[model samples]
Target chain A: MFFRRTRSIPEEYLQNIGAHDDLLRALFVMTQFDGRTVLDGVDLAIRRGEIFVILGPSGCGKTTLLHHMAGMLPPTMGSIQIDGKDIYGIPPAELDELRTHMGFSFQHGALLNSMSVLDNICLPLREATQLPEMLIRDIGRIKLDMVGLIHAQDLEPSDLSGGMRKRAAIARAIAMDPDLVFFDEPSAGLDPITAAEIDNLILKLKTVFGITMVVVTHDIPSAFTIADHMILLLDGQQLAKGSPEEILSSKDPRVVNFIGRTMPLADPAKVDILNYVAGVDSRLPEPRGANS
Target chain B: MSPSATESVAILMPSRFDRETVPALLQEVRRGIHEGQHRICLDLREVESFDSAGMALVVGALRAAREAGLQIEIQGVQDSVYDFFSLVSVERLLEEPQALPRPGFIEGLGGLALPLAEGSQKGAILIGRSMWGWVLSPFRGQKLRLGKIAEEIFQAGNGAMFIVALIGFLLGLILAMQAWVQLKIFGADIFVADMVAVGVTREIGPLMTGVLVAARSGSSIAARLGTMVINEEVDALEQMGIHPNRYLVAPKVLGLAMATPCLTLVFCTMAILGGWLFGVTTVGLDAMAYIEQTHQALRTADILAAVIKGATFGALIAAVACSLGLGVRGGPEGVGRATTRAVVTSIFLIILVDAFFVLFVKLGA
Candidate 1:
């Protein structure tokens, strides 16, 4: 006999992103865990059928922002609206219904290790639809084929390689044909060629299915390749929000530094192995004959 | 007038060709193909809406036509279905299905049996190695860490002291009350003291302690080790050439083995005290006289048996918990399952071992 009060949307939330054609929006979202702020005053809107990339370096709030927008985490302040509805303000049943139109691809794939790849893809469809088993299986197979993982349909998630697991996760995300898909580091842990292929696949999904994607990534090249609009985050703050070209040409020193940094070349003259070892073991006792 | 016209046939698709209608429509299409309609034309101009199932049927039909040396064509497809088809290529369906390798009967049976057999063998090995480490640790130059063993003892024994005392006291009171009814009829009401002391020391005290300890300490041991395995701390120890049996399992086994006997003694004392309380208040027996009778009735062998039973059950609990925790698979979910299995298995083995002692003592008597 437990009762909970239904949350109502604030008037300010309605004035912010309610009038836009945005399929997803975050209005001043802030998150704190154990008194440590992970996301601070983040605001953005994802247009319907556009690929919006959340670009950031490691340890920034890119994934945290994605989790908030996906309704997996409640922010400390502000609201997330999906389909023009404040997701947090709705009741549990309404939130669940809203979640049906959204899909999230975890960075680690997060496929249930006990189930096969095909079962993982079919999970949402089987739970939500009244379709026959054969039809569900057919749809599952089609999703697997779309990700080029049909050959691995029967294999467990533990059996898949990193790249294959990512592909399978993507297949599961798109299994319900959701309107909004969140991809967390889609090209991460993939080889250069495989990463490029994933980028191309993202583009293809956007163009053919018109599924709106919000990709969170630290990879500069991958972001530029697939992003229609993007926001760069640094230390839980949005540094820049614009197209890829705009991000590249951004006058902000942090954004420029993040995009412009490259691998430092090693100089042969400065490569002294003995000196390096000596520096590492400075506290070690001198060898018996070293002083002599 | 052309000779090819005899082999060709045309069929109109339903307007709402979806999962519900696809089956009937599919049956008709299959009948046409089965009846040797060589060139089939599926006219979808009338089909306004269709879903993925309908798309799958079309692709399946195209694949079937190619395989059967027949020609199939679809004309005037709608925009939405066309968009879906473009996303999931028809060429994918035309490609041959990959051969999924499935295990045969014998292989499947082996898959089920092998892990159980392996786990049993590993459990035996763990028990053997832990026993050896405990036996040989004193002789080795590196002394066992008394601090860690002492900490475990404090947690497992002292932490469980209150619940054990409460159950012991309640049990003693109930036993005396029940025994008073039968003994008073025979004018042997004084015998209640003897019965309470003997029963508590011989069976109830050790048995209850075993159940309580297994419920409390055994689960914690399993959960800790399982999380350690998940976090790769167990692997880290192995990488550093430190044996897990010596470092992790031995201390717990020794601590619980040492602490359980002390707890059993406490349980026996509390039960005797509870029986005295009931004797003085309800039975109207002289408290000092009841105490003397109880003292005389309890023998050394019975007390030894209780201590031995408590120690054995404690060691068994630690061993079972350690084995299941170290052998965990999957992830956090696997850790939870392992913890449950550890508690159940420990209690089961404890009772089994207690039964063995009961038989041994009866035969000796």
Candidate 2:
């Protein structure tokens, strides 16, 4: 007969974050994949009672940063502090305890297709609490109402529309009334109207429940509307960090170009068209006049 | 702002005082109380919503104030906050708590036993449902596809025939050759035919066929279904409200159960032929005489026993494979591990079941 043993972390190795005013702090965090650095010595502090958005172009390690902060992936170096405790230094049991106070929503609404929407929302409560089934159901219903999915609670995840699935996933994320909620591309595939509605919901949750939020997205409009603080990442490095307006006004060409979606161009009248047709070397013989 | 004039200090609260900010807010409140302000009013007009942590903060503040010979009053509590306070029974925080009794060994045992019992009950229900589907399929107008059963039968039985035949023939030849040497000293070399016939029909035939099937078909079934699970096809089926066992496992079970006995018969015939060939070439026994002796040695009960063992082993192998497949987790490596586990577990159980059948046959005799 075989039995699994749980490994425990020693107390002396755990870092204390009690002096920090920030709710979550990352100190010189780094992540490497196959000896290639994906997140290079990132230092950030997420203040309490704020919507902190991590904005970047595709493949800029935004999702990797979120995963490290959420404790789903450990940083290669340095530490992440959540609620004054080092996240990576904790034992698995203690880490699970910490995670109960945090919720993470995936980019594609990773709801279990085997369960109904109501069950999906109620799963956390059911697993973590000894609450009666009826009370759990009522809580699930309330979450559904909060997400405007009350009528669709009985439907399977597959039966839901894309927006509905995202809403339902958010509902499930907030089911336990977590202190912090992390969303990955919450509005990636939604229409503008639905995306705005999600943004409104994020703001409402922050104000009404006082839930600190960390959102990773490339949706500039949604980020500006919902974020209290924003960080712009370029190629795995922080390009800028400020309020949305400050980010937009940044003198850094990279920041400005990212936010405004502007691409630098040479003057069309600078004789570039013929040079491009003939190739970069102006000395190269031009193809015989096309008509000739 | 001066507590000396009014004797009551008013502390303005932030718009949000939930878990993240509660510690800082508590520290500030403690600082105010330490400054000799006997009366404090927490102004909450600016605050919109608060959770359990916020409630705890308020309770903590009130306790701190009382300990300092001060009185604290909460003002401008919103309706939403008040609703949560009432729902969670915030008043209980003010009451003194009782010490709880420690759990003993029996209690811990019972705690473990309860979940195990529940899991066993659920497993029983799953088995019952799958068995019902298997038994009722023919009467239900063939809800299970015939092509699928045929495919499984071909895969499990036909695909395994060559190896099973080879092993069966070799086993018979080895058994007869060994028995011939022992019996020839007593001038009873012909008894080798009887020994091979009885042993092959009653035990070796079914056992070899089962081991081969478990290694071949069992691993294939497990790997196939485990891959399906990794791809979320099983989840997709459940999302469509379809019972996976009824659709996936029953056909495999029913097909293997039907095929095993037939394969066992084929295996036995091959084994008897190999024994006859060995007896004629090595022991100088007439082929017809050896055949007659072999036919005389196999009783009807022996053949029935082989068929029973073959069918039982088939069902056991299929059921175990499907269970392991459905329980797969993690990723591609998980599917590989599950396939290995299914084959190992099926063969182990097959041997154990064979022992039980052997005992039953001995008692009947």
Q: Write out fnat for all predictions, comma-separated.
A: 0.31, 0.02
DockQ of 2: 0.04
Worst 10 residues of 1 chain B by lDDT: B114-123
Please identify model 1 stretches exceeding 4 Å from their true place. Answer: A1-19, A27-41, A74-79, A89-92, A113-116, A151-161, A189-197, A262-292, B1-121, B134-143, B363-365
Model 1, C-alpha of A259: deviation from truth (Å): 1.2
**Per-residue alpha-carbon lDDT of candidate 2 for residues A1-292, written as tens digits (9 for 90 to 100):** 0211124333454344224678998766677889888887677788888899999999999999999899898877767888777788778788888899899988988998777888999999889865545446656766677778877877778678889989999988888888889999999989978987898888878867778999999987678678888888888888998776566556786776675552223423223322332345344222111111
Interface residue Cα RMSD of candidate 2 after superposition: 11.0
Angstrom error at residue B290, model 2: 5.8
lDDT of 2 by residue, B1-365 (tens): 43465777888888887655766777788888998776899988888656544665676677677778888899988887875554333343343233368889999999756533443344345456777976777797657677878888888888888888888888888989989889999999889999999999988999989988989998998899999997999999989966688889888887888789888988888888888889999788998899889888888988998899899888878887887888777556667877887777777778878998879768987
lDDT of 2: 0.78
Per-model DockQ: 0.26, 0.04
TM-score of chain B of 1: 0.76
Q: How well is each residue in B64-154 modelled by candidate 1, as lDDT tens digits? A: 7787778899988888767777766667656756667899999999986664455445656887898798667778755677898899899
Q: Which stretches of candidate 2 lie over 4 Å from their true place?
A: A1-19, A262-292, B1-77, B82-365
lDDT per residue, candidate 1, A126-243, as tens digits? 8987666656778788888888888898887867888999989998998877788999999888997788778877887887778999999987667867888999999999999987
